[model samples]
Target chain A: MPPPLITARSLVKRFGDLVAVDGIDVDVQPGEAFGFLGPNGAGKTSTMRMIGCVSPVSSGRLEIFGLDPAHEGRAIRSRIGVVPQLDQLDQELTVMENLVIYARYFDIPRAVAQSRAVELLDFVQLADRADDKVDPLSGGQKRRVSIARSLISEPELLLLDEPTTGLDPQARHLLWDRLHQLKERGATLVLTTHYMDEAEQLCDRLVVMDGGRIVAEGSPRALITEYATREVLEMRFGRGRNEERVDDVLGVGERVEVLPDRLLVYVADGESALAELHARSVIPESALVRRSSLEDVFLRLTGRTLVD
Target chain B: MITTRILPSALLDVRSPQRLLERNAMVYRRSWMVIFSGFFEPLFYLLSIRIGLSALVGDIEVGGKLIPYDEFVAPGLMAAAAMNGAVLESTMNVFHKWRQAKLYDSILATPMSAGDIAIGEIGFAVIRGLMYSTAFIFTMLALGMVKSAWIVMSVVACALIGFAFASIGMAWTTYMRSWADFEYVPAVTLPLFLFSATFYPLSSYGSWSWVVQLSPLYHGVVLVRASNLGEWSPSLVVHAGVLVGLSVVGMAVTASRIKTLLLK
Candidate 1:
């Protein structure tokens, strides 16, 4: 078997009295795409920082490509690419200069850095704006340049934190495609995101975290299968109606959850669950049936609510 | 055993700190206007305050050598300008990149360490300060204000002064929470600029001259003025020693403060 590209054994991180990551163990095998899916303050970024060797672990062990992060941080860092949550491109530099200078930071030769920068700019679809200053680029263009800059060193492992957080749908899809291409080339990817579709679409394996602890771990498909039914029936009652009284609405599902804004019925077939609600003489103001996804897995693990 | 190899690789990246400094010069090549802006401010001060006001103040006695008011004030403006340029870059520009743009956070993710960043930035400031001082020296020479060839030493003195201010500015910038915190920099700097004998001689202040001697800018101006007047004394050694001491202390503080800010 190929070696695990990354391994963490009881890793922990603390900031003063607040424990950001609490004894989390993670393993990512070679060529696999791994994700940390959680809401804000869920310790996902903290975990990634430790793996990137930028933040020191408070306790326990972490090995990137079988090298210790503590003693071999620079070596580990040299072989890894990181896209931070916020774009950090130099505003004073042109887009191409941003890439070339970043390559220079890793000691890449000037000619090689220049050629690779051009390739990466083309890859990110920002070749035409190469000479434009970074400050004038739109949000998505800046993000693309940032991702391109991260790849300047041809890293073995790529780490992205909220890679598509603020991007529009079209821009997000473009970024996702670029990331897919990177994975196809056999690089290990580790990412953190709150977007369920992002996790389901990209991650081969993932861990769900909340309050600094891992609550679930599996493939996106396996996670949904274990935590939720194949389909979900959503019903939104009028604002004046009490959603907590969801049991009166239907009886066709194995389980039901009453959220402040809606009611979710977990079932093998969502269409049958909707029909059962109609038979009970209960009318939802709005209703929809959808396949179970990472969203359901997240709601089940962290309770039915969105967290900032 | 293997870890030792990892340790050296961290420091062995081909982009030495020197390369980073050279990159700043390349950036400056394209943005020469920004650097030229620093040079003109002092030249404007020399023209407005010394030339314009000198018509009333007449000649001034500096270091026991009678000289035109413009000639006496020119070297002090050069030193003050160098200090200003370095401080502006290290403080305002550095703070903007650190807090607003998130630039250093990205650079630190690469093979560069906080120490490299501190040195790289100061090196850029020194080079820039050198440019402004050199240009101002040429302007003085053209105006027939240079009393001796020793004015070349003033350029080096100003660069050293720039390093001291840049280091201190960088160290203080870590504590700046907002743009408003910068108000105190000029509020304090302007007082030193006015009272540090930049426009007049230290002895002209009579018994209170000792207070003027205590300011760092005063020491810098004294050294530059002494160099320009060709009156090198044992006190010149004391002035150089003070500027050197400031640079060391400032650099030590900045290095430690930046490490804390970046690593934390």
Candidate 2:
């Protein structure tokens, strides 16, 4: 088999006395949609910056396309596209001018750059705003323009940090569709997000990160199954009684997590678990039976929610 | 094992800075009023200082040569104009892009390195400085400020002066934390403008002439004046050397400083 498109062994990044990425290891094969799932300040952006060659790795072995990033940053960066956490578009220039000027950094010929800019603008559905300055564009349009700018170099690997953090649902769906098309064309993707649904929808394989460490690594389904039961029964009997009644359904499932607002019974069959709860005369204000998700797995590993 | 080689690419890639210059050109194309408005500052100074102040103070001597008050200060104004344009472009414009716009973050993602940004920004500053100098020089020629063919070479001098200060300005700006720190720019350059043997001869200061000798603007004024007067001296080499040396040292420091700050 050919080597993985990216490889990192004991990669470390430090900012002064703080260790942002503390000796983690990861590998990504070509054409795979890989993800880093973490909450804020979980070292996801730090890791992405090292991979992007914009931030220096304090110590570690990192190779992109078999080229050492520390030594050949320019060469490595030429093959990779980075959509930073923020939209860093030039507010003073027109949307098309942003892409064209970015292409100039790679020494793309003017005519070729213009044609590619036109095509990319069409791809992002911003062809009509090509002549307009970026400051007046809507948030979604600005993000699409940023994505278009990233693709101007036709990079082999695309790195997106929180690509859909603040987008409306419609905008996010459109971005997902555009990214899905890119993946279908065999472009390798690496992304980081706190959105579990986004990870489940996009990543083929991923690692769950917390506090500068990888707590779990697997496919979404594998992680959900391994870290949690096949289903979860959510029972809320008002705040005070929810905790008191937890012991009544103790043996109905493999494990139970008592949250402040509800009780979660982990079981292979949530329907049967709910029946058992009713037979025991434990009536709640509301009850829900649903399949397990990555959110459950994250809660199991970190003992906290992803967003808060 | 991994070893890093700093700036593995060629030192001072001309193409990158050229592209940066092109980007600025496109941006300014839409805002031609800003460029047109820059022309009036030096002319205003020439008319106000030369016509108004000269009528009261009379002709002055510089470098042991007596010349008309307007003639004496025209080249000095050109040099000051070059310094102003270069400093403003490099410091304020570059700082705004780096801090507020975060434009460099996007540019750095490409194959361009920190050095490319430094060179590119300086190149843009030099282009603007030359434009302002050209306008000032043409006005000087119209007002009978040109005494010889050597005035043609003063444009080159203006460019050099711009290059020197632009490099230094870019380097200095990296050390600035915010817009509040920019007050030092006018504080420093204004004094260089008013007291650098620009308005009068070194003899005006008498024993304190040593102060003018220490100012970079003094060398700039002498060089531009000599060219305008069709005089050449070996001392011109010293003046030109200072600007060139400043540019080289400033560029070197700026490239590495940007790398340290951004690539960390």
Candidate 3:
């Protein structure tokens, strides 16, 4: 196997007294799509900042493309593209000018930058709006312009922090498609997201983080297989019902979890568990059988729900 | 002393700094109206106060020569315009880019350092300030208000004044938390611009002349006035030295603050 394109060894970052990023280790290979899956304040963005070479590591070692971030920050930065959580496009410039000016930041020739800016605008489907001012573009269009600006340098490694947090579903899918195309062109991509579907769809491998520490790491499917049952039977309890204990209703399942508003019975076969519940005369307000997924694994590993 | 050698090669990298300055020029190009708005404020002061008010105040004696009141105030107006243009860009524009637009955050991700950013911004501000000062000087010459070609020296004085203010403005911007903090800048600057012997000579105030001498703008006005009258003296060298000293001290403070803020 090839060496990892990015590596972090016992990385730690502290903002004042609060440890924003604990001692976390990660390795991401070239041409691979890696992801940090976590909720807000889970240190996902902070970790991405460190690898992007924008924020210095408070402790431990970080290497990007086999170079130390502290000693070779400029050399490393020149070769990497970063899409920060907040869009930082020059509001005063036109959409195309934004891309062109960003190219200048990397010292790219003006003629080359202009040509590349047009190509990127076309790639993001913003060619018609190229000359339009940035203030008039919709949020989705602005994000697309930002993404295109990042690619102006033709960076070898790309770091995206929560790429589609506040976008509409259609816009999110559009951005995901663009990112997927970038990955197909052999760009090493590292992204952070709280959406399980986004992670499952884009990431080849991912790490789950909670409270600044990695709780688990694996492929989405493998994580589910390792940490969760084959199926999850969600049984919602009615209002104020002093219902029967979960042990009486879900005794046949391998494991049962009694939450405040629902009971989850984990088993190899969800159908049998539902039948057993019916046989025990414990009628739930609602019942559903669903295939196990990363959401289930995250819930099981961290808690009952994802906190933002 | 933080020697300049270890400050980071990124600051000395001319490519990115040139790009950033060009970017600011492009913004000015698109918003020429906004840029001219700053230029017009001083012109209005010159026309309304210097030209119009001159009829009431009559001619004034300066450097043992009888000079029109408007001629004496024209150089002061030019000097003040340079100071205002540089301060506006270095303070409000810099603060907006740093806080509201997050423009610096994106630039910092590139091969640009905070020091490069500071220098580029000050360079652009000085360029604009000189443009305005040159125009004002020509206007004074056209009106038969300039007694000698030495008035061109006022343009150079304007550029130095711009550099000093821009550097200090950048240093002050680092301490600003919000737009409300900017109220103090004009509150302090307006009083200095009005009472710093811009409209009248420092000697006119008698003993109170010492108060006007304390202002940086007073030094700028004195230098421009002396140069306008072709009356260069050793004291003018001292005035230039003071401007240069302020610029160096301000830039040093600004560079250190930028490293602390951006590198953190």
Candidate 4:
């Protein structure tokens, strides 16, 4: 309702002769958690960089807060926080010093920068290690420090590029909780991730990107319902036999996706599909019936896994 | 052609660079040994040349004037130290932060631009050079090397030399792809320091005197030597002009190069 915090029209980014981000359009409304989901080299990072006003757009129109990124970069960058794909924390400086100096970049007064740094370190649960240099911290702690540093400016919008790419499960859950709290406080978030579950958990709406193009865009459930069925029947046969009799289970569901070790049957009722498979004497080594998810929708649209 | 705006309002946003300088100061506060190590390098060169080498090489002629060998070499060493300080910060340190540490990548995400990073880095290099020069000048004064009131201008000369080297070093660093590329820095700077008349008169290398004159470090050595001995001449203007022009051109190239590299 607040006139879309960001809008990109035919956004394109080229690195010499390689077109990293092809023509695409995106609009992120205020207070929304939007995601760009894709595998490596899908141009998610390029799109995020263009939105953050750090990378120049090779050709196209990008506007943040109604200002063009090419000419008004400083103005736009001042109000957005970016957590780059890599943890660019200053290893030479203490964790607390990192946040304090970042705060100063926004021209925050010294005393304010110090105090805010204290609070942010506490927020990221790195207060105990505030005096320690980043080199000694764990991967998760370093990421938390980077997140805290990005928040030093109290930005209106936050751009997180692959925020949880290399973290453990627990660390990711912790970061997701922190991000949820931020969203609850009405902070707009734009994140890129290859993790389907991360997108389902964090993004209110997301677009699936592949080879520099958007293949699908919708909320998790809406995408599932539109591109997939209500439930999925997964049956895995012994390694060499999974694809042997694939045609024997043909019309049991709306569609069937064959993977290396399993067969995914998309149907309105997975339990009935399994029953039909049994009735047809197509016994599997293992069978599972569960609700369809974004993973199914993604595979349906792109014909490729999100992580590959 | 890309817009060649000098100190464009985009770059004139000085607050970000100020922040970068503060960050370096904070890091250095904890690692004082790094600063301490830099101090002894120039001091050792001065002590060895003044005490040991000066015994063999007595008074030397410089700029049409005869001065004590220690006096002539001290200020030249000071200028060389300025070059060393600036080049260390701009080339190796900047390259490390850019390639290995990714420090500027984080800074550029904020309101700071690549120009801010380059300026901030050069500003810190100048400050470090000033620290070394101030300490070197003090040591020279303690050794009774001050010849006239014009010696005060050496501080300004040191800062100018540092800025010129810092800008040029940073511009060169943009092209470095790996650590192997850094070997050229020492290979080039070492020869210039030895041949810039830092230890003996440029005339001693008769056939190589023109090479000495061509070295930027030589101009710095001449500038600081003239200021230390109160030997003002129109040549001082030429030395100052060359250093200033080098700084301006280096800075302009560095700014644009950094913009292209990081903002790509």
Candidate 5:
């Protein structure tokens, strides 16, 4: 529907000899919450920048809202909002001034900019701190200001590069709530994050990227089902003793993933896997049974945890 | 060859540079002290010349004409003042915003291009320079230093000088990789201010007068001094052309540098 809001084919971005974004294809439909999930230096930010029309594509074809980024960046950028990884809030201006001036960049008249700014600050829960400079605000409040500033343009699409990288749990939940409201209001969101929980909570469909390439792409549940078992049994042994019973723990489930401090057994039923482990006479210091998640899918696909 | 098209259309873009200028003005409004701080340096140099330096040399001769030492030194300081105002904005302020604060990164996230940022910044610095030049020339008038009606042209000359320096200063700043790189700002501008025929006539440089002409500030000093004393010659056009050419080159360099650095 709507012919996909964005489409990229063999998209490549290179900085001299270093290829940050290798050839990758992507499609994002309108009204969809799509994610680029990966660890650091996965070229997720590069892809977001190219889509935001701020960074030109080094090679390959990219179209946003049916316009080529290389020649029609201003046109494409006008209808999209971008929240950069770092809080780029204007330290010199008050929080309110930051939003108002950002509106002016999209050519919104002053009165309209002011009205929208007031409403947006209220939405981001920063209405009380409107007059204060950004330097004195908490990291969360500064981030909220950045979000409000991005929304001032009333953009059709929003690009968030690590929307919640360095926030406390409560602040992240608050941001998540605001983003949920935006989704309910029919805003198309494209975000990049290393947090599997953030991706699970926000993105409807996502691609797992590693070393500048997409390893997997699907809905959270679909990816876990395809790449992981229904439940995972994690048993931790003495720090350096996990390797001693590694062979005995094999074949207890569909497969096993060994972490530095623990062993993860993928199984349809965790209690049965525990019974089998007990039958093997290998007692663990601690054992946990939890449902499989995107983290599991990431581990299955990339052989590395999402956050690392 | 990255061609920076500083086109009329870009200037006319409704959303552009004016918004950038407005942001700068808003920042300055809250901290009037920063503006006044840059304001006082040129005046101190002028007044010190009036009270101290002028006492040592009563009058100086230039271009087959003799003028008060204060008159000769006033325009040089005025030009330097304008240059200082523009350079401060384009260099250190830009350095902070680009390096420390990362403000330009935020602006680039919007529809505003690097060219818009550069032009907006240079425009504001030129405006700041004009304000300083206006105040300085009027102060010269009050001190009875105005010798001719041509003094009105000094403001235009200062604006040109400021634009040239602002553009070049911004280009130079993009190459600064660390805080220590900024030491070159004062090291270069300080000596250039003193040696650009500001306190002494270019002929004082003797055989080195040709080298003096090569300095961008030398052309600015010549233009300001000639305008202040009502001295007219075809060389005024040459000086103005030099500034204009430098402005263009600087703008191009700054545009390309910002594109490579940020948009990478």
Candidate 6:
């Protein structure tokens, strides 16, 4: 792989007495989709903001493109794009003007900016709403417009903070498809998300963070393999009886996690584990056999779900 | 090779102050009526004070000659007009965009610097003020208020006031935290409008005459009045210098504040 595009050593961000991002180290290689996977308030956005060069690093070193962000922020930012947690598109301007005017900030010539804006709007699939004000667009359309605006500069590295946090599943899938195409075309993506499915779907490598520190870091499959069983048997026992049956489920699987409404039996083969439970006359109200995923990995690593 | 790599982008950065204008212009274009609406407040004041209040107040003496109440008040109103436009754009409009609209959050992610935002915002404010000043000036001229060539200096003074007030207004905006904090705008500007010798000569204030000169609008009013009264003095340079100096300081403070706020 080529040299990393971003490097942070003991990275820290503080707001008054609150330490938003504690000392942590990370490196993002070029042309790869890297993600910060954590629950909300886990310092993912703070780290993203620091990489985007909008927030000042309180201590330690952060270098993007091998230049210190403190002194070279404008130059570093010129080549990178940022999509904040919220859709901050210019509300008064039309969808097209939002992208075109943003291009002018990078000093793109007017004619070139205009042409690129047309294509970007088409890329985000908003060509029909080019002249419409952004205020009236749906949440998904507004997000697409914001995405198009960030791409107007054709940045080398795109930083998206919670790109689909508030979107519905259909909107999230649509955005994921668009992002997948960009990644296939070799765009470097650095995104933060609380959704394990989003992280697993987009990230080549990710770090699981909890409360301002990274708990684990690896590829999704590797993280799951290293931290979780191959499959999980989810059994619900007539609500309020899940915890009472925990002693009976002790030797059934590799391990068991007792949740409020269900019992997650982590084992190598969930199907055989469920059959074994039935053979032993250990029945449940309902049972589901599935592969262990990044959510399970996150729960194992942080002892809490990725999203509340 | 080295020069070719750096020159074009550097030139663009230097020219980015107007990028702020292009952004705001697109927003204001569809809402052009709202922008045009700012022109009429001072115009109405001009008409009402000229037609109504002049009859009640009669004449006032300045520079050893008696002048009509309307003549004395016109220059002050023009200065106040410039102040109003500059304040509204730099204060209320900027606050809305920064806090409610979150416009600069996106702009800060670009290559533009805080100085660019400061220049762009103050430039827009100054441009808005200039249009108002021009409209009000023509009204004064049509009323037979120009006997001396000094009236041209009023335009220049209005431009200076625009620059000074816009810069100062932007600097003040960075200190604001919430919409409630904006009440201080009229709390401060209203008093300046009334007591900055805007409607009356400073001589009428008696013992408080010296305190009135402390007002930034007082310098603007005095400068524009000098041009209207056709009484150009070497002391006019001091008034002009105060405004120019304030513009420089206010712009520097505003740029730094914007950097701290948006880029932090």
**Of the pair 3 and 5, which is ahead by lDDT?**
5
Q: What residue runs in model 5 are displaced by over 4 Å at the alpha carbon?
A: A304-308, B1-15
- Cα lDDT of model 4 by residue, A1-308, tens digit: 67999999899999888999998899999999999998899999999999998788888888999999988888999999988888998888888888888888888898998998999888988889999988998878888888899898899999999999999999999999999999999999999999989999999999999888888988987888899899989999878677765788879988888888888888999888889889999999899999888888878787752221
In terms of lDDT, the poorest run of 10 residues in model 2 chain B is: B1-10
Model 6 lDDT per residue over A22-127, tens place: 9989999999999999998999998988898888899999999999988888899999988889999888888888888999999999999999999998898889
> DockQ for each candidate?
0.50, 0.82, 0.71, 0.84, 0.76, 0.77
**Candidate maximizing DockQ:** 4
Candidate 2 accuracy as lDDT: 0.87
Once model 5 is optimally superposed onto the true structure by TM-score, how far is the C-alpha of residue B182 displaced, in angstroms? 2.3
Candidate 2 segments exceeding 4 Å error: A305-308, B1-15, B62-65
lDDT, residue B217, model 5: 92
Ranking by TM-score: 4, 2, 5, 6, 3, 1
Q: On residues B84-137, what C-alpha lDDT tens digit does candidate 2 reach at each position? A: 888889999999999899888888888888888889899889878888888888
Q: Give the share of true interchain contacts found in each model.
A: 0.53, 0.89, 0.69, 0.89, 0.75, 0.93
Docking quality class, candidate 5: medium
TM-score for candidate 1, residues paired by index:
0.90
The pairs that clash in candidate 1 are none
Return the TM-scores of chain A for each candidate in numbered order. 0.97, 0.95, 0.93, 0.96, 0.97, 0.97
lDDT by residue for model 1 over A62-169, one digit each (tens)?
Answer: 998999977777678889899999898887778988898888888899899999999999999999999999988888888999899999999988999999999999
lDDT of 5 by residue, A1-308 (tens): 57889999999998889898999899999999999999999999999999988778988899999899888888988899989898988888999999999988888899999999999999999899999989999878888888899999999999999999899999999999999999999999999999999999999999999989999999988998999999999999979887666788888888888788998888999989999889889789999999998988888888753221
Model 3 C-alpha lDDT per residue in residues B1-264, reported as the tens digit of each score = 355564443344334557768899878787676765577778888888654688899888887777888887888888988888888888999899888888888988887766678788877777777777887887777777787778888888998899888888888998999999999999988988898899888879898988888788888888889888889888888778888778767776776676678766
Q: What does candidate 4's lDDT look like per residue over B82-192, in tens digits? A: 888888889989899889998888888888877778788998988888788888888888988788888889999999999999989988998999999999999989988
Residue A131 lDDT in candidate 3: 91
Give the least accurate 10-residue stretch of model 6 chain A, judged by summed lDDT. Answer: A299-308
Candidate 3 or 5, higher TM-score? 5
For each candidate, the alpha-carbon lDDT, in order, equals 0.84, 0.87, 0.84, 0.86, 0.88, 0.88
